[model samples]
Target: MKKVSLFVKAMGLGLLASASAFAQYNPKASYEGPAKMNTWSVSIHGGPTQFFGDLREYDFYPVGNTNSDSYSERGTWFVGAAVGKQLSHLFGLQLGANLGNLAGMKRRQYFSYFRSNYQQVDLTGSVNLKSLLFGPNKMKHWKIDGYTGIGVLRFKSTAYQLGSGRVQRFTKHNAGDGTVTPAGYEADWVIPIGAAIHYEISPRFDIGLDFRINHVNTERLDATIGGDNSSVYDQVGSRGSFDNTLARKGSSSLDKYGYGSFMVTYKLGKNAIRVKKENGKYEYDTTKGTYHLRWTDPRNLIKPPVILTLEQIDSVAKANRPKDIDPRLLLDSDNDGVSDYFDRQPNTPAGSIVSGAGEAIDFDKYVSAALPGIACAEIFANVQFDTDKNIIKPQYYEMLNKVVELLNKTQCRLQLSGHADRRASDRYNIALSRRRVEAVRNYLVKAGLNDANRIVIDAFGSFKPIGDTSRNGLQKNRRVELRLVP
Candidate 1:
């Protein structure tokens, strides 16, 4: 049984270790970009520890080698504290100390006049360490979790009587008085295995209750009339009967001395992780400026305040070449937020909530109800861009048409935008993005769109991305987006 138990423990630890290691590789990719980074917590527990394995009960019966003598609890009750790290929402590890009593006995009524109380001082060493296992979710102020672990236990033991008298008492002392006292002894190593349930009170503190039994694999523990050490001589004052000691040999004892403990531990320190959301995307540009493409009022060109880049023309022209406006103008000559006047790159993308000058806005609400050109009221749809280009594509015609239709019908305003994947220079992409959007604005104006006041332009200059750009990232970077608002 002992061998099997040891094997089971080893296998369990192995499994937990394996899971602990593997679980981390699976990061929450879907997490909403911003999260906090660290946290800490604590626990307490108590219960009964039964002496199992090879415990010997001295029987007063003369007929058999085994005599079941009577005895009471010489010592019992355990307590401890722990500190640990939360690896995730579900797992953690802790270190603590085990302290308390581990004694028991039988009543020595007939042969002796005094009551026997076995007592022990578990001067448990710091080696007592434990692992934690939890069920369900973890890491919330009110979250409940279950845990279990193993550790090393060390202690000592002693016998105590009701009176200050040393030997067997000849009479009973008055009850309810200090006449009855407790004596404590010490003992060996113990293997403690137990379980507990805990609650996180806050990010840095948690409180819990635990119950576990410790198996002190030793004897010479029960020191009462029924125990092995009290001695058993003849009626004539000479050595007679056999030794009734319950303590075993080999690995100390074939039997085990165990105790149950309950404890409360308050943890200290800050140690939890929180993901935080930021304002910008990872792009290639540094300058701050807006871009332009077609005018939003489709019926007019608004003839862009900036020039369009090659990528920009390719985006809208696709299989064709520049018909009216020269493509070279796409290269901004003036660093003036606008592309060489009348060129497309003008206002940067809208809804990009910026600091001082640019901030990315949270647009989850306005896109569905407001006018197409409103700024930063709601999350706009993800607009796909041309390959390796921040340029708006003719491919976006359908989606853009939807926007145009919505704007025309509502006679609403709009802020145009531009974006570029990481493949081109920040300046090039930003400029291209500006021109592409200006083209859209220009087309809208020609298409009978009316509101000029409702139209605004903002260029992010290759900063935010609709998708990832690392190889498979192009699909992410290549794009433009619109946040609608009232």
Candidate 2:
């Protein structure tokens, strides 16, 4: 079994190494910096046990010989935390620890049925991960990894068979005297070896659906078939029995079982990149070998791959099978690190940087609080035009005066977009719209927007409707909108 497991590991690692080589350099020119390196994740997993030969718990594990039948270990569950690094676009590595239950085997006759249980408990102190297949780059929503490691496990097991249904504090020898007593029980420690497959749902969050199997050697509990005149034999005591009854060795009594579990983990910190000043500008080599840094860059390290066992990967993946989205978005529309559902403002325009609340922080103000972004009225004017011609009407001087006030008070960039109704040809509408937007620009310039270059004008040509395509809607649609941006 160990040889087979080793062969599988060799194949998996070889494939991942080959793939990572090609996948590393495939990023497009638009991808900035060395991509994010590592991730933090957490999860839980469990499944059934398989009893081996009749060696029993005592025969295999540390439990000693006893009158009680060998009891198998029950299944187990564990929750764990991990830190991972993307070795390449499609390959990564993770190190983590887990605490959960595991199961071992047992042999016993209970309630008229010969039943055995396998159960063990453990706390994962360490684990290693290596990804063979990673989720899509644009999506970064799903990924799978194989992992394994040795960790200390705190374990125990109990062995028992059906006692009298009635409570018995002690056995009555010739119990025509109908009094009863509760039966006694015993337990012991048994080390466990376990593994699983794991998957990540997102950088900070993950889902693991896994099956872990553990082997347990137990203390032998004899199954006496010989009929004896001894009370220890119960019914068999009443009947004389034979010498053919056998002894099940501890190794033969050893058992195997599977456990499955699920868990959720949260991570804190930023996935950053590092830049150093070289010849007055930032430059550094991103080679595979490690090097000491002259300066600090939180994101400089290209993370290495996770190196783990396949069995561990499967177990972890099974534990984290997601039924629904984990409430985190792979792509944030607001450019706030937080996802949309969690972000209070879902509709913040794209490319606009935002706060946790999704509120757009003026970029210029975001850069420096002292530099207050240009005020609203500085770059806009209600430039009324002639009813039929796209010419600025002289009657709107009062409205223009306010616009002039803003431009003089605060220098800002102006954006003017014009629209027209569906009454004219698309070409004619575009021409008229251009005149309308340009008229507003020309006025803003006269009112001292400072540079004509800072003013931008665009025409929609009735292509972008503000309301319904009706007479009233047309009136609203055939208007110009102005905005100020820093």
Residue 422, model 1, lDDT: 70
Give a tens-digit lDDT track for model 1, residues 1-486: 563475367447545643653353344431111223232435555554444321222422211121234333333455555655544433445666655544333233222211212232221111111222332212223333333344444333343332222343111222244342222332344444444544444333445555444554344343322333424321221111113222223333333444444445444433431111246421211122211100001111123366879998778687575466764344322222222344343333532321212223332223255554444323244455566444455655555665566665564556666666777788887787787567667766766666645777666656865335465456544545454444
Candidate 2 residue lDDT tens string, 1-486: 543454355446546544553454444421223533333333333223233333234433433233344323333234455554443433333454444433222233221112322223343221223223322321122333343332232232222233322211111122235532222121222333343443443434445555444433322212222212243323332211112112212222333333454545343335422333469644444442222111112233445478879998998998997787754454343333345666677667533445445566554443333223354322222343444467766665444544444444555555678888778899998999998887777776676555577667888887865446666555656666655554
Please give the lDDT score for candidate 1.
0.41
Q: Tell me how far the alpha carbon of residue 223 in candidate 1 is from the true structure, in angstroms, after superposition.
A: 5.3
lDDT, residue 305, model 2: 75
CA shift of 445, model 1, Å: 50
How does each model score on TM-score?
Answer: 0.36, 0.30
lDDT of 1 at 420: 68
User: How big is the positional error of residue 292 in model 2, measured in Å on the Cα after superposition?
Assistant: 22
lDDT (0-100) at residue 227 of candidate 2?
Answer: 17
